[model samples]
Target: MSTSSNRQMKLAAYVMAGPVSGHHGGWRYPSAQHDILDVRFYQNIGRLLEDGKFDMMFVPDIQALPRRLGDSLASQLTHGALGALRLDPMLVLTAIAASTQRLGVAATISTSYFAPFHIARSLATLDHLSAGRAAWNIVTSFQDAEARNFGLKEQLSRDERYDRADEFVEVACKLWDSWHDDALMWDRATPQFADPSRVAPIDHHGRWFDVEGPLNVSRPPQGRPVFVQAGASERGKDFAAKWAEVIFVTHSSLASAQAFYQDIKERARSFGRDPDQVNVLLGMVPVVGETESIAKDKQALLDDLCDPEAGLSTLSYQLDVDLSPFPQDQVLPDLEVGGVQGHYREVAELTRKQNLSLREIGKRYGVGPLRDFNGTGGEVAGRMQEWFDARACDGFMVQMPYLPGGIEDFVRLVVPELQTRKVFRADYTGTTLREHLGLDRPAH
Candidate 1:
């Protein structure tokens, strides 16, 4: 909305309240805490993010042990190579919300798996509890294991999943809208309660679901909780354009990021929505230190713990191909992979460009460094400004490589530098997540 030099970039923290964070074995770090079961551990993170003046802290949920490579789930669990244990992200987010007043609390749930009414009611209730600072990260669960758990033989095809997601969101929105803002009347003088005319049942019949709604919860303070989606595929992008207020992406290069930023905005425009309302946030993993050399050393620390076999297998799952049968040195075949087409396309291009073998790809998984920011405070801050100024992304979801240490480094070292440059806020100027992100509250 303003000149390039004057605009301030937004930042959110992406976390998973699992046993490990950052790289595969990040929980094994000397400084990393092992108390995943404790409520205090999560509250502390919420406070830290709030102190950093971060716009939001969002946690994604994985329903199952998303294992694809190496030998078994036991191997990865034994090594703590990936997220070791799972907790309900919603439960953790509520704990965070109870502790932090202003910080945005976001949690993910699968639209593909959960009933629309269930999600709509849950998020609405959370929004009320969080006092308008709640957000929902809508996901169409991709794990075959999760599908099996739901008593399905296979995951729906990508198109089918998105179609169902479209309907899922439709139903949720209707439920959220079923009760008007003034529907509740606490006029005790006349012994009156909610006005019935202000609430209507949404008789929704769709290909994916049928929900007779009037969600049990009241309308949320935010009108609807902020809708966040992280899907970079073509179908994913289009679906995001219409329903997502915040879109998360994974891109290897600035050029591709810029292309995505432009495309999503244009796609939003074509949908008769203001493009500015949609924030496209890229996932960034930064390793910051007091000095450039120190940062590189920290980067080396994670690289050593990277589990190539585990990483490659996970990649295979993302690409929807079974790489388990292939040799380490076998070249990734040019055959089309299913699941996430965007991920497949990005990796295919990388493989061709670098002529990388499966072994090389595997090692690069958590170890190789995706969006690495390795340098001193000033050096790292300058790089982030370049991306923001270049319009490559609206902002970043800082994927902290470790736990408190990863978060502390950026907040202590890099944040001040950004504030000094007038490219990031020193203090929060708003209360609700929408106001913090410069988005308007939804109108009834």
Candidate 2:
């Protein structure tokens, strides 16, 4: 490690597949590769993350797609012009785990639809499979389609969802604790697989769920996988303060980022926790090229691929308001309110702040501008440093502009610059996500 980088911040990458481009039409770029459903795709991505010295590559999963796109899921599915497909992040993470040694793997699972025990076992097992390098991006499924898939007519109210999430995480912690660190004693001589007394059932009966007993997997090497949360509402902040080790935040401007960062850290302090214990990571969708002009040109080309129908469809699903009737070039007003509060509000704020027309805002969805970094390696690195210095965030969640190439560009060009500037690591100092984040490892 470089001495100069000791005081600098850290960074992580987040990879979602089929079409995880920051902009609506990102995946359509000639250079962008797909077939992410294949296990090898993730393995390759993982090896790149490990080679790049990234803290981790988080994969966010959602139980349902934007069924609200139209009367059927076909428009959303056919919106290939729009970048909006996601594979099951957990299964992909497992493939990644097998290919890398030290890179941490994190995946999102919704607390709204999943049982606490189920979450506990799956995450703990992942931590074990990855040898202590796993992170869980705790989330609540927001779409009504997701609710229906769980055999419900509608999603729970926001407050109720968060309430259930609180209890869900609480139960997960208990189950993780149920199997003490030394609970397993693989004594070949005595033929004892594990200490039965050490493993006890949680017997948790909460308002939202009833889970009993210990997780099938033993306590992971890191004790519990690193907890991550991303909600921007008031209740969401409180939840983050209580449980999140890494808080993924999205804001269009530096001012907004600083405000949210300070507010969440102060809230953590009020919770009797070290504010620094939670690493605030800003999500930045990066589009980079060898030269500034080349990068901008590439971005423009990618932007051209957007389908107005597709973009509006996505916006409808996200904002819960259909803009299809509105002219594609028209500007969106603050006419409707919907969805979770993190990035949606930021998108609205971006239009007002930049005096963007409705068409411009819709274009923004197709090729996101509310929160992204686009430039040559040097330019991109400088912007990241500025955000870090401003105390706007402790780190960044690198969102790929294109598969493989998007990630490859950052690693090959931006990573070196960042390392030379001593703002990012050139080698990993530890194996687990928590250790890499500089958090104290839990007592065994």
Best by lDDT: 1
- Candidate 1, residue 204: the lDDT equals 89
Best by TM-score, which number?
1
Estimate TM-scores for all models.
Answer: 0.96, 0.94
Off by over 4 Å in 2: 1-5, 70-74, 81-84, 325-329, 370-372
Q: lDDT by residue for model 1 over 4-94, one digit each (tens)?
A: 7767788999887875455664676677777778999889888989988998998977666756664367545666655346789888998
TM-score of 2: 0.94
lDDT of 2 by residue, 1-444 (tens): 123335557777877765754666766779777676688878988898888889888887666667565445665787763325777778888888989999989898999988888888999989999988989999976777778888999889889989999999889888888888888888999998999989998888878888877788888888888988998878889999998999998788889999999999999999988887889998888889899899988888877887656666666676655555666555666664456677578777877778776667766766665444779898889889888878899989887877888888998988998888888887887888887888766664
